[model samples]
Target: MPPPHSLLQLIWLASPALPVGGFSYSEGIEAAVEWTGLDSEANAAEWLSDQLHLSFARGDLALAAQAITAWRAGDAQRIRTLNDWVLHTRESAEFLLQTEQMGRSFVEWLKLHHADTAEVFAGLPATYPVAFAFAASRTGASVHDGCLAFAFGWAENMVAAAVKAVPLGQSAGQRILARLANEIPAAVDRAMQLTDDERQAFAPLLAVLSARHETQYSRLFRS
Candidate 1:
């Protein structure tokens, strides 16, 4: 089993303020608003809510939970396989960049704090969730906690994106975040139970919006 997790470390790693450039990409939200006419706070809230349940929980969160187990068990082969799966499943080029950049940044953070295992992670093909799994593995966080933190971080970033792109007020953003938070626990629970073959990230709308976002003339997000 892994060592006891530091609550502070989990919070810190999940913070949007971390230097991972998470704040820069709207994860296709910008494109959804501009290209697809998703222009209201209510619309944004619903979109994020659906994403949390349909895409994130069923896909990345499950992968992260499984990977935390692999990392804790010192199963390097499983870790590499998980990493490759993430790389292969990205819906678009920009999505791929977001995962790779954030994964690299997270591993760099790990290097600063845990140099010994940093080299191990650095050698693998890092995707954001995969890198996060390795980071959480050291913390001995339960799969639920690890996936919750990951989802919370993604929620914050997405809310920040909406606040900027949809021009939602800060209060509106908080409300959105609150709604997203309410869904995290259940999503985490579902993710923890998924087997590898059951995992999926195939959100067609997100993929379409992401591809359109890449060439959008007046875009505010990376992907």
Candidate 2:
């Protein structure tokens, strides 16, 4: 088990109340709702579930796992490589902005508690996952627990987005959140099992939707 203080830190990091601007972006979920009419409770749950298993698990989750290892080892080069992958692999301008904006915000938040964070990430364009990994590395939690925290943070943010975009009630949102909670461990397992060679960020449909979302007629979320 992780240390008590570390566990608390993880919970804090996972909280939606963190000032990371995670609530502003729906990660193309709003666009999915607009373009694909993904409005029902069942469809939203399935959509988010598929995204968790397909796109997120294969991409950012895996990247964060590797990045946590790199941060722990003080491997600046590996961290750079991972950050570069995030920058280049973003499917759309909004997606790119979401990661970069949230990453910068998270770093600034870290600076309030950890003085050296600014210097440590001085020259690097740290993406969300990489910056988050750095914070996780500072905790006494194991890599697995850190990743769980990261994934749950993401799931909470996405579910909130779904609640608004799908127009679901609180109870429906809780059901979706419960479903995602059950699936997170398995998703994390797959993310951790991936090799650098096997890591990928290829979700063509999501990319297309995100691109279309940039010009979406009406929208509530940023991406």
Candidate 3:
């Protein structure tokens, strides 16, 4: 088990109000809604679930898990490699912007709490997962638990996006959150089990929609 204070820190890191501008991005969900007509409650829930498993779990979640280990070990080379991978694999402009902007924001927030943060990421273009891993490493949580926090944070943000883009009621949002909550542990398990070579970022549909969202006539979220 994690120490009590560490557990609390993890919860805090997972909060939507952490001020990393996460609430401003729907991570392609807005595009999915507009382009694919993902309007109904069931469709929204299913969309998020598939995203949780197919795209997020395999990509950022696994990367963050690896990055947590690297940060704890002070492996600067590994960290840089991971960060570069995230930057290069971004499928669209919006996707790239979302990761880079949130990463910069998260690092800035961390500097307020941990003075060394700015120095640590000085010359690197940290992606969101990599920056988040640095914060999570300080919490002394196991990689699995750190990933749980990460995934839940993502789930909350995406569900919020679905609520706004789908125009669903609060109850529907809660239901989607509940479903994601139940599935997060399993996704984290898979993520934690991934080897460095196995991590990948391949969500073609999400990429296409995100590109479309860049030019979307009306928008509620950044990506």
Candidate 4:
């Protein structure tokens, strides 16, 4: 169980403004738009909506929830194993690099705030889910909030990408965001039930697109 102060810590850790460089990447949405001719706002929205519902919400959030549970149980080895496995499993080199970069940044930021007690967890992969769990556990956040936050954060990035690639109006983006809020709770619930192994996702098409984006003469995202 997390102490009260730990909950506040978790909130801070998960804040969008934490400077993790997550905003720069669209998890391959950029490439999808460039290569697949998903150029229109409506086309981008539908594709993003499906991808969010089918892939990220169902997969990554589930893994992150499991990781949070493991972290709360003080299972350091499980945390490391999960993060490393996720790192290797990511098919795109750029996507893998993005996660690793953010993970390392999150851990480094946490280190400056934690005392000697958290030093061991510091060197772990610091994957987004692992970091989210570490923050939640340390801050006393419930499993529910951690999972929701993780899902919401991921969902928002997709929405952000939609806003950019779709070139949707700001109000249109906000509308999409509002519509998404209704889906998140259910997604979080589904995620809570998954085990680490079950969290695996093989998004080969998306991976190939992302890798291809690397050689695209003009690219905006790191992955």
lDDT of 1 by residue, 1-223 (tens): 3243466677887999988789989988998888777788899999999999999888888999999999989998998998899999999999999999998887787788786855696567588898888888777667677778889999999999999998899999999999999989999999898888899889998999899888888977778
lDDT of 4 by residue, 1-223 (tens): 4566755665566466777777788788878877787776567666766666677766777777777778778887888887887787778888788878887777777777676536756466677667766766665678787776666676677778767764677887777777677778877787777766567667888889889978977766676
Which pairs of residues clash in candidate 1, taking residues 3 or more apart in a chain or in different chains? 27-223, 28-223
TM-scores, all models, native as reference: 0.95, 0.98, 0.98, 0.87
| Residue 35 displacement (Å), model 1 | 2.6
Error of 3 at 12 (Å): 1.0
Best by TM-score: 2
| Regions more than 4 Å wrong, model 1 | 1-5
Candidate 2 to native Cα RMSD, angstroms: 0.7
Model 1 — TM-score against the truth?
A: 0.95
Estimate every model's Cα lDDT from 0 to 1.
0.87, 0.93, 0.93, 0.72
- Candidates 1 and 2 compared: the better one by TM-score is 2
Residue 202, model 4, lDDT: 78
